[model samples]
Target: MQLNPEKDTELSQKVNRETARLPWSELMRHFASGNVVWIADELDLVDVAVRIAHDDKASVGQWMAAGQIAKVSDAQARDWLETDTSLWACVVSPFILVQQQKIRH
Candidate 1:
């Protein structure tokens, strides 16, 4: 089977858009339940803003204090991320654990 380049690009863009539009509340729940994951690439940096209320610094700050989400440094991500190594962030924990996307259909 052959893949259409245009379709692939369109789908990729769509996924990214979806990620950025994720609601902050949902992200908080992900942190609370340990169901969060992300890629460690430059694009991952943009991925952080995908959370719903990411635009509201106040709300984000509150979530950070409550341990719902967190932003880690590059030095910190270097510890485990060796493959596509890039940006690093976290969901409630001090460590960053990015998972590769392999479930997309």
Candidate 2:
């Protein structure tokens, strides 16, 4: 899911706004990290966020604001992904399921 450059910039801003300490690049990298991948499986959130960032950064901001993704500090997000596999999967799975449903529909 390739996002337009403009949207990517905006989404990055939005994600940053919600997770103050987690920069967009860092977040993406974190999502892609081996630990996160092993614990949480695929990174659908990062993929979608990347796509959304390319198109509508504001919407990404809205998602972060809506508390769909646990808006924790960078340390906490990292810790959660590291220590809480079930919780991390719970948060990430819904987005992937929703996206799958959208594609199916």
Candidate 3:
């Protein structure tokens, strides 16, 4: 059954149920081509980071601090849609995690 985000609780510290998920393969393709992906997935920021980058969850936080990854709002994602770096993804939450490299080693 499809998850009803409307009936769920907030995803995490900064994310909420308003988030959504996108297919991963297409996401990877877009990222591989050097495009920015605005992720609206409702996930632990760490997990999302880990999923998208070589760094583990802990390292993901560091990446965030280092500006390797970023979190954006739905509005920002929407605004970005028209930009060159406008690729997007959402796995379950409202957090938008982005990195400038490959997720796998």
Query: Which candidate leads in TM-score?
Result: 3
What C-alpha lDDT do the candidate models reach, one value each? Answer: 0.39, 0.38, 0.40
Could you tell me which residue pairs clash in candidate 3? Answer: 21-90, 22-90, 41-90, 41-91, 41-93, 42-92, 42-93
TM per model?
Answer: 0.30, 0.27, 0.31
Give the candidates in order of lDDT, highest first: 3, 1, 2
C-alpha RMSD for every candidate? 14.2, 12.1, 12.3
lDDT (tens digit, per residue) of candidate 3 on 4-105: 344332233223232334434335444444454443333344346334433245655665566545544455444444453423333332233443222322
Q: Please, what's the RMSD in Å of model 1?
A: 14.2
TM-score for predicted model 1 compared with the true structure: 0.30
Mark the regions of model 3 whose C-alpha exceeds 4 Å error after superposition. Answer: 1-57, 73-79, 84-86, 92-105
lDDT for 70 in candidate 2 is 38
lDDT of 1 by residue, 1-105 (tens): 244667656645554444323333334434455445443342233233333223446644555566544443344334433443332333323322333222222
Candidate with more favorable, higher lDDT: 2 or 3: 3
